[model samples]
Every structure is written in structure tokens, then in C-alpha cells.
Target: MARPAAKARVPKHLVALAVVAILGLVLVADYLWASSSASSSAVWSSRLNLHTGPAGSTPPVAKKIKEDKKSVGSTGINATFADLPAPELKWEEMAEAPVARLDGAAIQIKNLLYVFAGYGTINHVHSHVDIYNFSDNTWGGRFDMPEDMAHSHLGMVTDGRFIYVVTGQYGPQCRGPTTRNFVLDTETKEWRGMPPLPVPRYAPATQLWRGRLHVMGGSKEDRHEPALEHWSLAVKDGKALEKEWRSEKPIPRGGPHRACVVANDKLLVIGGQEGDFMAKPGSPIFKCVRRSEVVYSNVYMLDDGTTWKELPPMPKPDSHIEFAWVNVNNSLVIAGGTTDKHPITKKMVLVGEVFRFNLGTLEWSVIGRLPFRIKTTLVGYWDGWLYFTSGQRDKGPKDPSPKKVKWVALGTVCHCHRCVVCLFF
Candidate 1:
């Protein structure tokens, strides 16, 4: 039977082919397929950006994003800033204004900067406010303030149209009255009184949070010092004057700090004069000792009133710094305040220097120094540029010349971290 099966005739080509030849062809194909697959997998992985999406089904699930809302910047920098709010710095030397101020209150609505209640000589605060238009770089004399507020650490907020000037101190003469809140309508250019602050408050850094105006620690009614009490003012009329003062969670430290901003649903308070000694005349007694700067390099973040997490403070110790005078794009910029104190210096007061902090990165870098001394005031930013209206240009007699608004582009703002890369490749 075996001999009969082997007797079948085979073609010449088939008889010449060895089993090894067939096996070799199979091996070559398998090797090529595997090599190609491995290379393709690596290439595809480089190109693949797979974010987990909903499972394949009629109803889908929403993917959870870890990032908070306030921290979102332009996705790729090419997106339109249509709905984004852009602030512009405009100087008003064209018109007749008395003194350049640092402690003034600025509010924005419809791209107009309404300035009020700044520091100057003889209790003079341009009662007649100035309105600046960033679009045309023009100034219009608007409504006059009913009262003069001097040396009052002021906090300001605008509810789309109306702006409210919140708690600040009067001066260091004696104990000052706990000032009531003043609200103004940017559109109508009128001022009215809002609900009284729950406590004697002043100079707290104020900012808008999730559609609500929040005021943080600052110099209170006692004197040129910041009180730790934090209060939030909410406006129901969409007008600042009609809002009510409701006490919110206080910062862990019960003393006024210079500036505060909202990030990650938490309030970040910068620095203030804390625990610095001062020498006085006619006696051996020292006053306002530890006038802050104790925690100059300290940073405090509050997730809630009950919990305050400490982040790295500024690399440098500057107290009572002008939070508004420094401009940072999507970051917080603050100008000089204090470093150290001596008989020659009351508290280390620095001018013209600027420091910027990125909440996302927790990074601090000195951005730029002003061309002229910008003594103090709130800083505003627009389109990666900085602008500030100085209270006093320097420690000297106020220049009678019409005050000029100063501005510096962030790229031109300074040399450090100021990137100048030409993209022509």
C-alpha cells in the first residue's frame, strides 16, 4: 500500500522544490509582517493623542477635567479673544488733572477706565473723576466724587456697569470713622451708597470671583495697617451701590495683607507690612513694630475659611506693594512696597520695580522696572502689556504738568523672562 501511494507522478517543478524552501518563504513573510507592525506601532504612538472618551453607546458619559475654570488661558494662542475681557492703560496728560495718584480706585466697563479716590496733597482726590478710553487713547472728565478720600487703602469692583468703592482708611491723624461703601454706575456716571461694611474695613485687596466681588486683608480703619478681616460684597441690582456687605470666611492670619486674587476656587493673598519695628521721635518707644514684612516671602492660599494652605511667598520680601500697578498677562503682577526698614527708611519702600507671579506654576520673576518711578497704585493688564497711573511718580513735589499715564509692553516691559524670539524659520 505504501509503494502504491508513492508511485503518484509529480511535475518537474514541484519535485525540485524542497520543504525548506516553503518554510523559508513562510518565515520571511512572518518576519516582514512583525517588523513592519512594530515600526508602525511606534510611529502611530507618536501621532496618537488619545484622551479617554465616552464608551460607544447612545448615551455618553462626561469626562472629568482636573483643571479649574479660572486658570484656563488661550488653548493654543490663535483662538479669538472675543468673549475675553482685555484691560488697557491710558494716561490723561492731555487734560488738566492735579496729582498723579497711587492709591486710587480704577474700574472698567465697556473698555472705559473710571478712576477715583487717589492719594495726593491737601486731601485732594480728583472728586471730578476721569474716564479713559483704551480704544482711542482719549480722556473725558466724568462725574465728580461727592467726598475726598485720602490715604484710604481703597478697594474697587465693577458689576458689568456699576463700580463699588469699598473699605479703606482715611489717614493716620487719629482713629477714623468706619467708612461706608460707595457704589457708582459706570454707564450713568453716578455714585450711591451701598450697604455698610460689617466691620471697620479699609485697604483690603478686592477682586471679582465667580461673578461676586471679594475683598481680602489690607490696611483697616485703625491706621495705615491692613486688618485680617475679609468681607465680600454682593450686588443684587447689578449696580454696585445696591449691593449688601456679607461677611465671608476670614483668612487664617487676622491681619491686613496687601493683595488677594482668586485662583482654583481659592483666594491667594500676597504680602503686607507685618511685624516690622519702627522708631519714633521725642521718646524711646517704637510704634507699629512688625509693620508686616515679617512674612514678606510668605504666601497664603485659602481653600476655605477653615483651611489656609501656605505656598512659597515672593522670592523677595516686599510689604504693602501696589498690587494693581504691575501688569501681568493671565498672571498676577505687583509693584514695590517694602524690603527692610531703618532710620533712613520708614519701611523698605521700593519703586519702579515689578514682580510677576504665575499661580499655575508658582513661579516668581521680576518683570521690569518702570522708566519713571511709579510710586504706588493698582496695576492693570491688557494684551500682554502693563499700565499704571502712579499716585506719586517719586518722593518729591507733585509735578504741576498734566500727569501722563505710563505703559510698558510685557515683551518690552523688562529683560528678564521677557522673551524676544523671531519666528521666521
Candidate 2:
């Protein structure tokens, strides 16, 4: 009788209400557990993002990554300043150049420097060729270029053994721009002619890359008018073949005296002066004419030879007629150029600042300054050293003084650690 009384049915509404209450309690517990888990994950993420390095010191790998991302697009290649240290340059005075000259081209091959024609004393251009032997630190071998091929403000490049000299001013003080091309055999000390450039130009940057010769950025017959045309000459049978100068994409803008170098299989054109070089009033070359020299700091790179991509500009506007630049490891080291102008000093001042451009990042940084100002000098890189020889200091344009520097400054580029050891121990 008691079991039957307990089994009496409860109200349907009350039973449904009890079930809903139990479900609400379960839902509240689940939300609390999820919120706690989310908060713990947030704390973990915050800790991960707080990773820091030593005060005032860069984490080498992380810094490299950041620089690469900023300079070049994501290249997936990591480089550190520690491994490829900023070039430690040391200037040591060596034997003087045989002759004082400017606006010449020089190349280093097998511990020897072959300096080509440039302007000599009395503002006269000469065809004199001199050689500097590193083994003895002496300038001995002396030769003259062919009377016809001898010219200053020419574009020159070397493919290890052969030095290719391209178009340049003919004579009469940088008047005639010739299309003549020639090659010199270093071992035999012989010179041979090659196919001429399609159009005559002077001060165009020339380089040999992947069996082709690239010529870019120079002036036409008039030294002032910049040429925007670009041309390439192919090589066959280990020699620059005689063929038509194949036209390629023009530069973004034309300029004169732009520094050209082949680094990382890419062609880079550095700062130069824009516009034409009009003759100034009372000038010896072309008197009573207005001359406008516009300097630039822009940089452009041509990787495929069909398109030019603008890169980070130089730190300052520079149009040093004769400056030295070379590809050192992954950097383009530029040294000893006048700032903002070519004449360097109407007031007798020149720039000794040295800078380096990182190829991976396409970024430029000041490495160090030269001991003294140099312009119109031939710079040569050999065996981890840069040679700055026979350049002019800040002499007034009309000074007529011996503008050519006699001292040969050797900049031994070493790693930072090696430089430190040399300085201390």
C-alpha cells in the first residue's frame, strides 16, 4: 500500500521545468570552462610575444630577418652582419702612381692594376696606360693605347683576362663621342678591336655578365645630353662577338657618370648627374655658355635587362665624375666621391665618405670615411683590398694645379674581428 502511494504521478509541467533547470546548470558550467581556457591561451600568447634581446644589442638572426624583410622582399635567405661584417677599411700609403690622371678606367687582374687613359696635366687627355704590380708595390709597366682608341671618360670592364673598353670621347677635350670598342688581353698585353656600339656615347656604365656586355646611361655626342638607351652585346667563342648592339629596355632616366656594377647577377646603376654639361662662362672647354649639372641620388636595378626597378637612393646626391665602386661579398662598396656635384669644390671641398649597399636588402649604410677626399680616381678591388690610387683632391676648377693624387691608398677590407685584432693585438 505504501509503494503504491509513492508511485503517484507528478504534474507534467513540473517535470518539464525540472529538466530545463538541469540543462541550464550544465550550460553555465560549460561557458565558465571555455572562458578559463581562453584566458590561459591569451596569457601564453602574450608571453611568446614578449621575447626580447639584450639591451642595446641586436639579436643577430632576428635583426637580419628584419633587415631582409625591409630591404628586399621576403627572400627566405637570412644574412647577418656578423658573418659578412661591415667592411673594415684601412688606408695605407703605397708607392705613388707613375702619372697623375683623372677620369680614367682601371681593372685589377692577378695582383696587377691596369690603368687606362684619363685626363693628365694641363687638362689634356692622354692615352697613357700604366701598370701597378702588387708583388713589388711598384709601378713599372708603361704602355700607350692606340692613338685612335685613346680617350678619357670611357666605359671599361674586365672579364678576368680581357678588359673591354667601350665608347668614349675622341679628342679636343671631350668633344667627340666614339662608338669604338676594344678588348685587351692581360696575359699578352695585346689589344684588339671589337664591334662598335650602335650609337656613340660617353660615360656609360658597362659590364660583362653571363656572356653578354651590358651598356647603360651616358651622353650622346654632346656630353651634356644623357642617353637613356641601353644595349647589350653577346659573347661568342669566349670573345665579345662582332654584331649589332641589341637594344634593350631604356633606363628610367638618363644620367651621366652613373656608377654601374654587376652584383648577384644583377646590373645596378648608382648616383650620377642629370642634364647636359653646358659650358660655363670663362670656361676653357666651352667658354661663355651656361652649364647645368644636376646631381641625383636615385638607384635602379636591371635584373632581366628588359625592365628597370628603382631601388633605395644613395644617402646623398653624388655625381663624382670618377669614384670607385665594387661588389664585395653581398654588398656594393662605394668610396671617395664628391657630394651632390661633379666639380666637387667651387670652394675647394671634397667628400671622403664611404658607403656600402646591401644587395639582399638593397639598403645603403655608411661604413667609414676615407682619409682624404678623392675624385676622378680609379678604384680597384683585389684579394679583399680596395686600392684608391691617383685621384684629385679639392682643387678649384680653374686652379690648373696637379689634380692627380700621387699617393696610393690601400684599404684592406677585413672582417670586424680581424680589424679589432689588428687594432689591439
Candidate 3:
């Protein structure tokens, strides 16, 4: 039975204030959700499987995966690059990941991509390791982490041969071995210990910039999101710098960690919940705001800590927009993500929508759509297309199976992971 609205109230003024507080929280949450939509999942903290082909069209031969060394165009798919009606990934019974998991971030160490640490049903955070070889299309494994680290929303980046993972939260209320930075060597398959972060935090902006691993602008918990406060770990013999912590010009009105990538020799941060950050992340929880602050898409780039300039915002603020290149020969492509309140449902743990960003023009557009409503999302880019996995993918109206099950390459990898290295020359 439903309680009557009038009789249930404890006090008048208190009720009103509570309502206002609720509204404020909802509004800010909405704003954050609106401004950012994750291409990847953010449970710890957050691409589309975009193929370089016309809708219902076929793929061409000789595809190239864009890494720091190469630049390609969307050749056979569409030279002009027109957005296609979204397609729900076809869920297949035979082609699922050998193992099932979520909250794991994939870091590419040279030709091999490793999905490190994830959260599962209960105590599902395993040091389990899955290795994929793009050249041979093989899935193998080495040893697991020395200890289990299973928070989804951590920050990570690779410098040529090694992956530097830092600042993730585990249990409730942002608990941890906070301040943990794990460095994995691809050749030895060994974990080297680095100095812990200055504080315990998750979702910090991590990237390989100017040959140093830049770890900056992240939050600890409910309170305190750090500023420009940049710290770089200089690589020695492919190892991290002597001192883990250093400082840089802090971003003024610091905000929550948005999408951080090395772009054009500069540190580029994009949309997130708070507008304070020059850059931000994509979120769907803040949908109404997405509808309201329609023009909140801004790309903030910092050059050597001296310049903070805003490149054109997205045509509109599109959250949960994933990034990839349409084909081996294509420009950078941003695809898949939804515009809806998260916890979309306990049964459905993710959002579903497909959008793309143009690296060349700083524009945003909707291309293909998800086949089914999805939750727990990730778009893994390898070879020429992306392998959308672990997520519940929408197949379409007539054939909807919420769970996306596969290791198939639905699309291509982006222009070298959002930052450019340009072997394109």
C-alpha cells in the first residue's frame, strides 16, 4: 500500500528543506551525469565497437589498427564519413569472452593488450590476467597479480612498453590500499612497485605525455577533487622516475577526473561531471542536464602547463560517447554510450547509445545505435575494429538479448588511444 503524501511527513519546514536538498543533489548529479557519458564503465570509475563500413555494408581488405605510430582513414567504409543508423551488436552463443568480468581497464603494451583487474558478483576482483595478441588473434594468459586489485574506476596509461595503473577505490566510502600505483612489465610479466600516490584516489587523469607518465587531477572520495597538481614519473630504462610525486601548474577550478589522453603533444582533458575541469568525462546519469545545458561540450588542452586553451566543444554535449577509428585507414572515431539515468535497472547495468567524435574537427555526431539496451559496457579496440564485450548489448526490437557476448571486432581502434604519436608521417 502507498503512504499518503500528506500524512507521511514528519515536519513541514523539514520536509520542504529535504525536498530542496533532494532537488539539489538530483540537479548536480544530473549535471555531472549530463556532462559526462562514459565510453567505458566507471564502477571503479569508463568506446564503441564502430566498424568502418556503411550500414549493413561489408568491410574491406587490408585494415590497420591506429596506435601512437599510425594514422589511417575510413577508406572503404565512407570516404566522406556520414553517421550511420546505430546497429545493436549481434549477441552470439558461440563467441563470448573465454571468461566473464567487468571493471577491468585494458592497457596495450606494444602489440599485446592486457585487461587488468575487475569486479565480479562477489569477491570477483581477481588478479586474473587475459592477454590478447592483435597480430595472431590469440587469447593467452600469464600469471595473475600478486594481490587482487578489483575496483573498476582506476586510471591507467602505457608508455611504449609498460602500463602504469594508479588510484582506484575498492569497498564502500572510497576505501583501499589507496595511493597504490602498479607497474606491469610486458616482457617479464612482473609487477614492479612504484611510490604510492600522494593520497588515496581513483579515476585520476593518467597518460603518457612528453615521455613521462602524467598522474593528475583526481578525487579521493565524496570531498576533495585535486587540481592541475601534475606529477610525472619519468621513465628510466623503461622504468618509472625516481620520485613518484612532483608538481605542475594546477588546473584552477579542479573537477572530477574526466577523459585524459595525450593529444597532439599536449595533455587534453575532456567533459566530466563538474565543469571545473578544463576537460570532462561522458556520463548518462545526468540526462536532464544534457537536455538543459545543451552546449556543455568543451575540450580543454594544456600545453606544457603554461597554456590552457579550449578547443571547440562538441556540436552538443554527448556523454558516454566512445572513441575509435572507423577503419585501419580512418580518422579517430568516438562511438557507443547512452543518455539515461544509470542503474538503468539492476538487471540492466549499463546504457546504450552510439555516438562519435571527429578528432580532426572537434565535432560530435550520432552514428549507429546499439542493438539492445546494454549495461556494464566496454569497447575493446584491436586490429581494425573493436571487440565489444561483457556488456549487455541490445540486438534490436525483434531480437533483443541484453547481454553482449563476444570477442568479435565490431569496429576499429581510435587514433592511437585519443593521443597522437604520428608514425603517420
- What's the lDDT of the predicted structure labeled candidate 1? 0.47
TM-score of each: 0.59, 0.68, 0.59
User: Which predicted model would earn the best lDDT?
Assistant: 2
lDDT of 2 by residue, 232-342 (tens): 899743376656888888898886777887887888888877665444545556422335666788898888867889999987666654337766667776766555432
| Ranking 2 against 3 by TM-score, winner | 2
lDDT against true structure, model 2: 0.60
Model 1 TM-score relative to the real fold? 0.59
Per-model lDDT = 0.47, 0.60, 0.45
Backbone Cα, N, C clashes tallied per candidate = 28, 2, 59
Each candidate's root-mean-square deviation in Å?
A: 25.1, 25.1, 14.2
Q: For model 1, how does the per-residue alpha-carbon lDDT over 272-326 read when each residue is reduced to its tens digit?
A: 6544222233323222233344536577887755677888777565555534533
